[model samples]
Target: MNPLVEVSHLEKHFEIRSGLWRTVSSHVRAVDDVSFAIAAGETLGLVGESGSGKSTVARLLLRLITATGGSVRLEGREVTTARPAEMKALRRKMGIVFQDPAASMNPRAKIKWSLRRPLVTNGFEHARIDDQILAMLAKVNLGPELLNRYPHQLSGGQQQRISVARALLLRPRLLVLDEPTSALDISVQAQVLNILLDLQEAFGLTYLFISHDLNVVRYVSDRVAIMYLGKLMEIGPVEAVLQAPRHPYTQGLAASSPPMSPHQRGRQRVLLAEQPPSLIDLPTGCRLHPRCPFRQTICEETRPELRELAPGHWAACHLAENLPAPQPRDT
Candidate 1:
C-alpha cells in the first residue's frame, strides 16, 4: 500500500548571517536529506535528543516552514511544489499538536473561540460550528462547561485536550503529535495518551509522533526512527530498533533509556565517547563518527547510506552487518 505521507530527501538549511553585510556566513543544517513515510493509521515515532531536527521535520511536513530541498507527498500529492490553493487544501488533511498546548492558544480568547477558529477559517458553517465543537470536545473527553473559560482557566491536560479537539475539528487524516504529553504530570500524561490512542482508533488516524522520550515513543509507536544530527541512524519495528538496535547511535540511545524490566537492569549500557558534532560545522562522512566507538578509517572518510539490515530494519552504519547483537539479552 502507498504511504499516507511520503517524504523524500527533504532538506531544510537555515542561513546564518553575520557582521554588517548580513551576507550568508554559513548554514545550520537543520534537516538534511531526510526521508521517511507514514502508512495509513500507523504511528511512526521520531526519537532523538533535543536538536535532532525532529520538531523541524514536523514543521516541514506541515509546510509551516519551507524546505531548502526535496519532496513531500501527502496521499501521493506533491506538497513541496504545490500552489497556495493546493497547499491550503492539503492543510485540511493534516493537523499538528504542539509541545505546549497553552502557548499554542490565544491566552485572551475564550475556549469556544479557540476551538471554533479552525472550523471558521476553513469555512465551516456558522450554524453547525457549535455542534461540531461540542462533538469534538466529547471525543477528547472534555465537556462544554470549559468552553466559556479562557485558556488560562483550564488545567494543562484540559488545554491539551482542547488543542487536540481543535486540530481534529477539520477531520484531518494525518496528525502530527509533537510531544503532546511531555508537559503534564505522569498521571495526566497517561490519561492524555490513553485518550489519544482511543481517538486514533476511533478516527483511524495516521500519526507522526515526535518526542525525545524513549519510553513514550516505545509505548505509542508502531515503528520507531532514531535520528542524530539531522540524519536517521536506524528505523524499524519498535522492538527491533529499541531492543536490538543496529546502529551505534541507536544502541547508545536504547542502552541509556531506563530499563524496561528489573531483570534487564544488569545489561551493559552503550555510551558514545564524545559529544554530538555542531550542526553548522558538521563533520564530513558520518555525522556521528566523532563519537562512534567502532569508527574505522572508512567510517571517518566516507558516509554510509541507509541499507536494509533485517527483514524490515534499516540502518545507516557501515559496521551494522559486522557488529555483534546488542544486549537485550545477557551476554
Candidate 2:
C-alpha cells in the first residue's frame, strides 16, 4: 500500500542576519536531507533533543514553513509547491496539536467557540456546526458541559483534550502531535495518551508524533525515527530501535531513558563525553562523532548515509557493524 505521507530529501535553513546592513552572516541548518514516510494508520514517532529539528520537520510536512529544498507528498499529491487554494483544500486532511494547549487556544473564547471555529472556517453549514462539534468532543471523551468554559478555566488535561477535539473537528486523516502531553502532569499525560490511541483507532488516523520523551515515543509509536543536528540518525520498528539501537546517538538516548521496570535496571548505559555540535557551525563528516564513544578515523573523514542494518532497521554510523548490539528490552 502507498504511504499516506512521503517526505524526501527535505532541507530547511534559516539565514542569520547581522551588523547594520543586515547581511546574511550565517545559516542554521535546521533540517538537512531528512526523509521518511508514514503509512496509513501508522504512528511514526520522531524523537530527538531540543533543536534537533523534529518540530521543524512537522512544520515542513504541513507546509506551514516552505522548505529550502526537497519534496513533501500527501496522499500521492505533491504539497511542496501547492498553490494557496490547493493548500486550503488540503487542510481538511491534516491537523496539528501543539505542545502547550493553553497557548494554542483563545483565552477569551469558550470551548464551544473554539471547536466551532474550524468547521465554520472550513465552510460547514452553521446549522450543523453544533452537531459536528459535539460528536468530535465525544471522541475525545469531553462533554458539552465544558463548552462554555474558557481555556484558563480548564485544567491542563482538559485543555489538551479540548485541543484534540478542536483538531478532530475537521476530521483530519493525519495529526502532527508536537509534544502534546509535555505540559501536563504525569497522571494526566497517561490519560491524554490513551485518548489519542483511542481516537486514532476510531478515526483510522495516521500520526507524526514528535517528542523528546523517548519512553512516550516507545509506548505510542509503531516505528521510531531518531534525529540529531537536523539529520536522521536511526529509524526502524520501535522495538528494534528502542530495544536494540544501531546508531550511537540512539543507543545513548535509549540507555538514558528511565527504566520502565525493575528488571531493566541493570542494562548497560552509553554516555557521551562531549556536548552536541552547533548547528550553525556543524562539524564535517559525522555530526555525532564528537560525542560518540565508538568514533574512528573513518567517522571523522566521511559521513555515513543511513543504510539498512536489518530487514527494516536503518542507521547512519560508520562503526554500526562493529559496535556491540544493544541488549534487548521487553516489549
What TM-score would candidate 1 get against the native? Answer: 0.95
Badly placed stretches (over 4 Å) of model 1 are 259-270, 329-331
Clashes of 2: 0
True-vs-predicted CA distance for residue 265, candidate 2, Å: 16
Model 1 residue pairs with clashes: none
Model 2 sits at a Cα RMSD from the real structure of: 2.8
Judge candidate 2 at residue 8 and give its lDDT.
97
lDDT of 2 at 108: 89
Residue 32 in model 2: lDDT: 98
lDDT of 2 by residue, 191-297 (tens): 99999999999999999998877789988999999999999999999988998889988887777545322454344234555557789999888998888888898
lDDT value for model 2: 0.88
TM-score of each: 0.95, 0.95
What are the lDDT scores of the predictions, listed in order? 0.88, 0.88
